[model samples]
Target: MVRSSAPLRRLGAELRRLREATGRTQADVGEAIGRSHTTLVNWERGKNKLSKSDLVCLLAELRVPADVRKGLELLRAEAGTGTSPWAVYGLPDWLRPLISFEEDATSVTTFQPVIIPGLLQTEDYARASHATAPQLAAPDNIERWVAARMRRQQRPRNDPHFRLHAVISEAALHLYVGGVAVMAEQLRQLVKATETDNITIRVLPSSRGDHAGVANNFTVLHFANPSADPPLGYFDGPLGGHMVSDAGDVAAMVTMFDDLRAAALAESESASLLAAILEEYQ
Candidate 1:
């Protein structure tokens, strides 16, 4: 019974407005609620859903009057019975959390060993790539999936706090799912995306032996919400996707990323490597 996030997002916005109206900083609000400033920040930014107790405390501390509190309580109760829109389309249940994370992430870093990360993929490239995916190949479902992926790209434009960094394997650039022309265009898009202030692209050359990400694709999502507990890790599998948020697991993934970064080419070198591959495709 995951609810549509609209209510939660609105709640966050209202909380922020209320705090501002009261001329209270996040720290001040946090102090009143006996939580850390970061946690309060996360709440106001809609990066994390509030627990029942946390919501009650927040409403009390914010001095939300009876009517507003009752309305919020109703929304919360309703949230428990509604399904996430994504579930209707056959996305794996576990992957649902990633949708919310993507919506609120301030920054995302991905290590893709096999394919172009989805957010940067062109529509034709995504369609062709999905055509071979047995589980996702149903024509109707594929269109929905492609639409979802394309929509993910809109985040950077819509969310001023959003930033992305990607490290891609050289093999991904050379694989011509939609032929040389499409691949070439995709590479050009990557180059263009790199020029953006909030995006960075790096290539892990095929010659770079024994990389840490040889095993899988993984992403770390960092929240801008000061109240966010911590960054989270996600990866895909036959069962869809899995999220790892336990402190130790998240730390290990972060450490792995750091090691992989060290093993891969520097940003400039990676860009040069990507350019060379694009030239070959041309």
Candidate 2:
């Protein structure tokens, strides 16, 4: 797979926006030119740049207006432009794409089975979440990860257009990670999140056993522009996590989310549940 860069990603975002406006699926475009779906997805993700002929073919298939074609041509010519700070931070290689995609997302949805989602975790909670691993215990590395988490978190807070909907398993509420006091503080922080209009949290009760999310955590990031950039699905892998763009994979992840959501308490109900759990620690 081709690595994504800032410039190409921007171009892909543009193409995605245009294509969606015309109601053409990635498969629709790829199949027209005998390109694989993976290749089409990669191009839309800015991971791969399409050649002039390919771009022309795509533009023609999308039935782009003559007036708009010139602007797209300019964008295509500069698609391979931009760098990111992911390299400077020395974060894991597999993580860079996720970080980039998340930052640009219009909305994000996450489902976590055993712990608070990193974006919503308190600093101490985040530390405890990772403290279980000896490899991450060193002060410097812990700080690095925490710092990265902090930076990643700023998007939803700072960007008014960005939204987050996270579904958390009830199992995480009972864990004594970093002790009851830490859990208490973390729960308190969760309550504060409800105050934000753009953020919504749901808790999946333990009673709803054997669900699709029993396997692993996943995040779905939606873009405002479906043509320039489409929604992306992410899941953990052996190294870090993998990004899913293929229609089938992304659809499966969405289905998993729907299942998790069905079993989860609504935002208001989850807040009440969280408040009840907080009292136990006190």
Give candidate 2 misplaced runs (Cα > 4 Å): 1-7, 10-83, 136-139
The global C-alpha lDDT for each of the candidates, from Candidate 1 onward, is 0.77, 0.81
TM-score of each: 0.70, 0.75
RMSD list, candidates in order: 9.2, 6.5
Per-residue lDDT tens digits for candidate 2, residues 62-169, read 887887888777776654334555545667757767887786688999999988898998888888776777563565577677778888889878887799999999
Residue pair clashes in candidate 2: 7-81, 13-228, 14-228, 15-227, 16-226, 16-227, 16-228, 17-227, 17-228
* Candidate 1: tens digits of C-alpha lDDT, residues 1-282: 665444565566677887788788999889988999988876775545677888899888888898988887776664454445565556545656688767657788889888899889999888888887767467777777777788778987566568888888888888888899888888888877776788777888788877778988999987765343367789996557877756678788888887777777887787777778788888
Steric clashes per prediction: 4, 9
Q: Where in model 1 is the C-alpha error above 4 Å?
A: 1-90
Minimum summed lDDT over a 10-residue window in model 2 is located at: 79-88
How far off is residue 59 in model 2, in Å? 16
